[model samples]
Target chain A: MSPTTTEDSTSSNHGYAKTSLNTVNRYRGRGQYEYQHVYPIIDEAPILHVAFHGSPDQDDFAFPVILPMLGCTGNFEEDPNNDGRRSIYLHGYVSSRIMRLSRKNPASNNIAGAEGIPVCVSATLMDGIVLALTPNHHSCNYRSAVAFGYAQVVEDEPERLYAMELITNNLVPERWQHTRYPNKTELKSTGILRIDIHSASAKVRAGTTGEAREDLKDETMRTKVWAGVVPSRMVYGTPLPAPTNMFPGMPEYIEDWVEEWNEKAERYSAEAAGL
Target chain B: MSPTTTEDSTSSNHGYAKTSLNTVNRYRGRGQYEYQHVYPIIDEAPILHVAFHGSPDQDDFAFPVILPMLGCTGNFEEDPNNDGRRSIYLHGYVSSRIMRLSRKNPASNNIAGAEGIPVCVSATLMDGIVLALTPNHHSCNYRSAVAFGYAQVVEDEPERLYAMELITNNLVPERWQHTRYPNKTELKSTGILRIDIHSASAKVRAGTTGEAREDLKDETMRTKVWAGVVPSRMVYGTPLPAPTNMFPGMPEYIEDWVEEWNEKAERYSAEAAGL
Candidate 1:
C-alpha cells in the first residue's frame, strides 16, 4: 500500500474547495491560509473571479480575500448575457505603488479608462515547501487568492468623486478626508469601476508530510538531507507617515487591518517554524 | 502636446502594429520577434535581438538579452489550431530532493514515474524588477519560462541508464560521466517527458524612467518621494554540495552555468552600486 513498494494509490481525495462565482465555502484544513507550504494555484483562482460590492471585509463574498491596494479594476465590457454578471476586463498593467510614481498621464490618474488599457494582475510571495512524508501527504503551504469581476466606470463627476473616496478608503481606510479631492477636469480624466462578486475556491495542503511504511523502514533514506520547513512571513512595521501630511491620526480601520495582517503573519511563521 | 496639458489633441495611431495576423505583410513582425524599446516587435530589426546571443563573454544578459533556458512552445491555452507554436503544458511537482528530506514518501528515490503521480516540472527564476522613474517606464526585469510536453517513462534498461546521464548532463553538463547512472528500477519508476519549445516571448524594460515635463517643473512633485528603480537580482553563492556526496572534479556543464550565473550577479551588483 506504500507509494514506494506499491503502484496503486488508495489515496483519492486532494482536499480542495470547489465553488462558483457567488458564495465561497469556508475551508477547514490543518494549516492557515498563510502557511508557507501553500502553493500558488493560478488556474483555480484569479483576482477578478468574483465581482462584489464594496464591503471587502465580509466573508462568503469573494472580494475580501484580495488586497485591494493594488489596482483591481479595469475597463468594463458589457456582458453579452443579460444575467448581470457585472464584469470588467483588465489590461496587464501591474498597477502597484510603483505605478503611482510613473504618473504616465496625470489626466488619467487611474490606469483604467486611460488609453483604454485592460488589466491582468497577479501578486504572490512564496515562503517554503511542505513535504508530507507520505506520497499522498505531499503538499505545499501558501496564502493566495484570485479575484475577477467587471468594474463599471464611474463617469458622472459626483459618482467618480464618491468612488475615489471609496478607493482611498479601501487603501488607507480614512485618508480621503485628510487629502485634497480631485477637481472637475481631474474627475473627468480619472476612471472608476464598480466590481461585483462572483465565485471563489481555496486549496491548501498543510501539516506534516505523510510517509510510506516501506520507506520509513529503509534506513538509507532516513537521513538524506536537511528536512524542515523554512519559515516565511510578510511582516509590516508601523507606517512612516509622509513629512508634509498633517494627519488627525491613524484611523482605527487602517490599524485594524494591519493588526490582522500581523496576527496572521505570526501564525504562519509559527507553523512554518514547526513550533 | 504634453498629456498633462493636452486636452483635445488627436492621435489616431495607438502604437499598434498594422496588418493582420492573417496577412503576409506583417509576418515578419509575427514569426521572428525583436525588441523596439520595451515593446517587442516582430522582425522590424531582427539583427539587434540576436546580437546579444552571440556574445558568450557577457556575465549578465543585461546589456545583451539572453534567451530563456527553455523556450515555451504553445499558446497559454490548449488551442488546437496553434501548430508549430512550440508549447508546453506544465503541472507543478515537488522535486525528489525536497521529498526525501521532508520525510514524505518513503520511496528510495523521489523522481517522477517512481511514484506514478504526475511529474511537475519547472526551471525558472525571477531576476529583478526594472523600475523606471516614470510610471509607464516601470517594468519588471524577470527571467521565466515554462517547459511543456509530457515525459515518456524511461523503459529501455540501457536507455534508462543513459537517460539519468542525460538529465545530469542537461542540468550540470559534462558531469554525467563523473557520476553513476540510475539503476534499472530507478529508471523504470522515473518519468521523463519531452518538452517542446514553441511560441515564446522575452520581454525586458531597462534604462531611466520617463520624466514628465510638468513633473520636472513642479518642485512640489519632484521633492515628494524617493523615486527611481529598485534593483533586485538573485545571486547564488558557491553551491554547497549535499553532505552525503563527495565530488572530486567538476563537470564542464555545471562549471559553465555557474560561471555564467556569477558573472550576471557581478554585473547586477555593479549596476546597483552605481545607483
Candidate 2:
C-alpha cells in the first residue's frame, strides 16, 4: 500500500539522484543518493541488513536471505529528517520469512517496475580502522547504506502505531512514552515492512587513511609503517537492571540515554576518524 | 583450489554441529552451533555482511547483495577458536563483483552437494539494549553470526599470503608486522573469498530483557516503564594520523590494539549485559 509519503519529489534535490537501481558502481566518488544522504544512513544504523529474494521459485537453488532487520526511517507525517518524505519501517515476526514474502508479492504488483519483495537494505557504520601505509591501502572509516526497496505489508493501524513510535524513538529517545502500548497480542505478533524506497545509496568512508605516492615517498616505507585512525565507536555501557526490576534506580530516560549515546558515539567516532 | 589446509577435521568436536543449512529455526534455545559459540561471534564482528545470490539468471529480479565485507574466522592451521576447523576469509576487490561471482561458481563445482557462490555469512555484535517489559519483550543484547558457505575463489599464493596476514591481523593486532608486504602489483589487485564453511550458527542474546509474566507482576507497569540493559560496546578510539603520516607516534601496535579492543569491548559488554 505504497503511499505512506513515499518521498520522491521529482528526485535530485541534493542527490539520491541515481537510478539504474541505486547506482554506485565501485566507489563512484563515495556514492550518495540523497534524501539527505540516504536518511542519515538509515537513521544511524544499529542494524538493517535485509537483502531478500529467498526461495523465489528456487531457480538454481535461489537463496539470498540476509536478515538482521529492525528498522526505521520515518513518516507518520514529518521528520524522518524532513526533506524527501520517508518510508523504511521494518520490524518483524508476523510469522517471519520476510513477512511471508512481503505478503505474497504486493508493491501494487509492479506497476510496470520494481515489485514488492525485491529488497536489499543494508547499513554499516564502523567509523575507523584505516591504518593504511600499505597493506594495499587499508580502509574502514565507514558509514554505508544501500536501499533499493519495495517491501510493503504494513497494513495500517494508524500506520502501525506510527511505525511503532518510529521504531521506539529509534531505540531510546522517549521510548514510546515508556512502553506497554502494543497490545492486541502485541499488534498480532508484530510485523511492519513498509520500505518503498526504490533508489538509495550512501557510502561514506570518512577521514585519515590514504597512502600511495609510492607509499608516501617511501622514507623507508615512511619510517617503518604506522599510518593511523583507530577510532571505531558504539558505546552505552552501565545500565543492566531487569531481573524483575522493582525499579528504584537507572531511569532518567535510561540515564540520559546512556549519556546521550555515549557522547554521540564518542563525538562522531572522533569526528569521523580525524580524531 | 580449496586446499590451503582446508580445516574440516572430521566435524563435531564442540558445536557448529548443525546442518540442514545451519539450523536455528527461531530461538531454538538461542542456537549456537559451537566452535566455542561460533568463532567468537566470527571474531568479534566489526563488519561482515556479505550475503550473495546475485544474478542467478535474474529470477524475480534476483538481487541479494549485502556488502560490508572484510572478514576473519581463521584456520591457517590452528586457533580459529581451535575447533570446528574455521574458514571465512573474505577481503575484496580483484575486479570485484564478489570476486567475479566466487570465480564463476567453484565449490569444486558442487561435488554432489553444497555448491559455491551460495554464501550467506552475517555477523553482528550489539551487546545490550533490551529495555523490555513489553514492546514485545524488546531485545538485542546480541552476538549474531550466520555462516553457511561455499564461496571459493582464493587461488592460493601461500593462501593469499595467509589471508593477507589474517586480514592484517584483523585490522591491528601486530598490524601485520608493520605493512608494505603485498607487492606484486599489490597481489594483483587483491581478492580473497574462501568461505567453505558449510554450517555455522550462533544466535546469543545475552542477559536481562524478559518480560511477560504479566509485565513482571505489573507494579504499575514496572514503575512506569524502564526495564533495563542498555550496555552495548565497541570502542577503540584515539589514533588519527595519516596526512602523509611521516610516522612519529601512534603505534605500539596501534596503542596495544586500541587498548586490547577497548578492554575486550568493555568487559564483554558488561558481562553480556548482566552488568
Model 2, span B1-275: residue lDDT tens: 22234444325666555644456676789887767788778777878898775554432244567788888877655543444467889888888777887777765333235556777788888877887876767878888888766887777788878988887787577777877776898887888877777566778888877777776667976876778787888788788786677767766767876888888888888888783
Assess the local accuracy of residue A188 in candidate 2 as a C-alpha lDDT between 0 and 100: 76
Error of model 2, residue A139, in angstroms: 5.9
In candidate 2 chain B, what residue range of length 10 has the lowest lDDT sum? B1-10
Going through the candidates in order, the fraction of native interface contacts each one reproduces equals 0.00, 0.68
At residue A247, candidate 1 shows an lDDT of: 35
Specify the CAPRI tier of model 1.
Answer: incorrect
Name the fnat for model 2.
0.68
**Top candidate (lDDT):** 2
- Each model's lDDT: 0.30, 0.73
**Candidate 2 DockQ, CA atoms:** 0.25
Sliding window of 10 residues with minimal summed lDDT for model 1 chain B: B45-54
Give candidate 1's error at residue B257 in angstroms: 12
